[model samples]
Target: MLRVHSENELQLNADVLVIGGGPAAAWAAWAAASQGVKVIVVDKGFLGTSGAAAASGNGIMAPTPENWDKVLSERYCLGKNLANLRWLERVIEKTWLSLPLVEDWGYRFPKENGESVRQSYYGLEYMRVLRKTLLRLGVQILDQSPALELLLADDGSVAGARGVQRQKHCTYTVRASAVVMANGGCAFLSKALGCNTNTGDGLLMAVEAGGELSSMEASNHYAISTAFNATVTRGVPFGWASYTDEAGNDLGGYINGRRDPSFLPNALLKGSVYARLDRATPEVKAVIERSHFIAFLPYKKAGIDPYTERVPVTLVLEGTVRGTGGIRIVNDSCATKVPGLYAAGDAASREFLSGLASGGGGPNAAWAISTGQWAGVGAAAFAKSLGASAHERVVYPVGQAGLRSQSNTVETFDSEEIVRGVQAQMFPLEKNYWRCEQGLLDSLASLETLWQQVQANPKQDTVSDVEFSRRAAALTAVARWAYFSALHRTETRSEHIRVDYPETDPNQRYYQATGGLDKLWVRRDWIKDAMSGDKPQNVKVVTGAIDISGKDVGAQGIAPLPRLSGHAQLISGDV
Candidate 1:
């Protein structure tokens, strides 16, 4: 049965409408509301649940008495000196300031030596911190409600978003002067997004409303537990383990294996077991072969259970880092090239990589929180300047003809089955430490065909159901873009590997190996138009590297070399 709400049924006008309820969303809402802006946040799950940060855990990296400067230097260098120095400095500053806010709100971090500890990295604490802050700030939370569409004004700026309360089956339009999309990436919705769960909905919506997207093609592939299912269930520290040949011969020692200096030239290693592995002479290899690999041991020494018993273990091929491509935001205040749109957390890119801390600590959650706050505050300020008149109504077809089709129902999606299939294919091909053109092309073709099947029979009914369909549509678009971008980049760099192009090409070294990079090239047209005072220009060139540093680092062998040939290929191209 379908239900319709007349225009008169709409309720609530807010200064900001935040979509998604993860840590990013929480901080965004809190930041905006704290600015005295009435904000409404809609989410698809309960607070403190879902989203990558929560699902995996949350941690903050701050300068403590122990190793403040060392951590900061490591983060800056990990970005390959290509990051925005000003933004990085701001984030580092904000991280320290925000820690007390989270603690005051309700969250607590692990302390050492009983001195109100300065630095302790853990993800769970980060989530708790954001949750407490949002609640304390008096932000109205509409959990289980997912945003369906970005309401655009006559001038094409985003005014608000329409949403559906799933449990109640009621439609509500949240009118706001500004919209902040803090929804996590579309990695989980691979079937719908056609790539990883990061469907690029926020980016796409912003783009459709004249916003721009950058670095869609880059994805971070961490070294996770490979024992049980090769799924990234647990984070593996590079210094924790070393890889051995099938014959049990130690290829490298743990200490020397931290990260091949040649591969990740900017990476830092301390107390690294992999480093020992790399420095291993024949005698060291022989000794290591007889000794138990310490990495396989549980984190029991650190008060955590051993991962090998709980999950699986695999040798760390390369040092883990954030995804290669990220959304580009040139402005100092986290504003995208678009006026009314802002991005933060994993979705925004300005040269900072997400996961890099001392001793294999997960992504610095405090940085994410602070960035969200910055974005939220900026968005609210922008909205305030626009005034109430800027708020616009979004008129959609509400007649019977607007009813959704039944084929798109969630009941039709075998998520587990689909996930298993995707994992099987991606784990070997795209997920391999090294990837090839043939495998990537095959994976893209197979996934595309599967996505087409899902699209051909999209489920529909009310706005809630339709939203799922829309997410699926967005997922397909993202996946197509990822695949298309991968197909075009013929060099091996970062996590993106092409077996056919096994060697990293000096000519293509500066280019991002993802489709989102292409979007950045196109975005220049907007910049040119803005500068020339002309109509928005559309410049499309198939191949050109982003000018991070005028000099090509690849020519100098500064970029990491691609390590292929160890992993197996996709199975029969079935997945």
Candidate 2:
């Protein structure tokens, strides 16, 4: 079924299609190919050099049977009873097994006492080995191809996807029996090193196809980084580093010899903040230099020693890239509510493991490896079940609002402005990190206005235009979902801190479910019922409709949102 329709279009067919160019996408393709099915991977960048995993070192949460009980207990407790123990147990086991496989495939783990260390990995080298192994498996890889939207079969299952080939200046369409979405998460264009391209593209495409998002309120994650630098946000070195305010006053943030995660952001709310690693021992300094040599390069160029000099520090908004929010997976197979479609890694919510808290670093890396394998296996099995009639189904493209305008007439709008507007709402620490009822409402109203602008614009004329517009729409949609979910939770829990509702409410023990484009809805779903595959009752919050001209259509007073029996939707007057 592979065809060259013209010089501008390339059509392809595969048993399984994996979207993304990260560690999760690589593992998914590997797993699918292991099932003896034809698999294709499409990435926005090169396979081995894209995504957050490729630009950072990560320590994996791999536990053996001996320590599994202790590790699982601690991690589950960290989630404050929202993390699912079953999923945590599965992640530990899968991660343990998967790491050794990587070593067997020629990745050399750090050794100690004549035994290979399996605790961590260097992102760049790890991905290179993985890319090599995948090529050996006969998996076809498509680089620099970013999928704009998903296609659906006549029966409403995901059929395949279509995207622009940036390097080729054309378009490519793939028809497949099953698809895996592992394209990572949105960072609101924060430029956090490797996360520039992680703009919730998969999340938006999935939602447009009737998929739902869970725990999006947990998407607010900020990492402490040196001023004017996006790389090297590693917190270990900061453990011994001391923080000071503009007047050189101590912040009293040293807790158990490590700085609290909230210390920097809280200090930043007032004025400038700076850090000094003067307390780091020689051993710590050596580790920092060896592990983060790239980060120190700029410092060396500027003739500044971070160990001795005062370095200004700022928190970078990581958004969903480090947060535990994304497309809701319905089962252990990482399958979404839409059949034949699966999601993994940052593209799928990790709430089953991290709940309302952030699951960046170790927990996220483990979840990526485990869920990627599960999704791939599930997709392959589904594809195999289709037998020879897989390609016979009638399919339609489901992309809208990005590839084409939601409105009939093509309208002129600045996509970059839309992206910047989203950043203004999401990237600020005071607006997103600290939550107040009025602040949430204001941010939501602004996001709604931006969303309307996106909906009115038409498809672009070039590949870059299409990608830019799509990223803008995707980021705006993600911010809206996060704010809506945050608005509904009401209670302060884990990473979701509501200043108005400062205390944790025992009654709010459910997850918030959000979906819909024109009619954005947020509903509370009982965790137990959701886990058991039963439909849970919905508790809603009213966010009155806002018009496209940035006017409040039916703005309600600053009163407590009543717990409505039915769903509460945030609609736009333009829509």
Top lDDT model: 2
Backbone clash tally (model 1): 50
Cα misplacement distance, residue 394 of candidate 1 (Å)? 5.7
Superposed by TM-score, candidate 2 places the C-alpha of residue 452 at a distance from the truth, in angstroms, of 0.9
lDDT of 1 by residue, 1-575 (tens): 13445454446788888877766678888889889988888877666655555544333566653554566666655643333334445666777777777667665655658745535423445666666667777788887776656666666566777666777767777777777777655453322111233445554455445554444444424443443333343342433444443344444432453555223211212111112124345665453333323332334344543323222243222111135343445454566655676777655643444211111233335546766887789889988998876655452321110123324443444324444454454434234435566666566656655454443434454555555555654444445444444555576654456668866443332233222211212211111111112222242332323332221122211222232343122111111
User: What 10-residue stretch in candidate 2 is worst by lDDT?
Assistant: 543-552
- Model 2 Cα RMSD, 1 decimal: 6.8
Where does candidate 2 stray beyond 4 Å?
1-6, 255-258, 529-575
TM-score, cand. 2? 0.91
For each candidate, the alpha-carbon lDDT, in order, equals: 0.50, 0.82
TM-score of each predicted structure versus truth: 0.69, 0.91
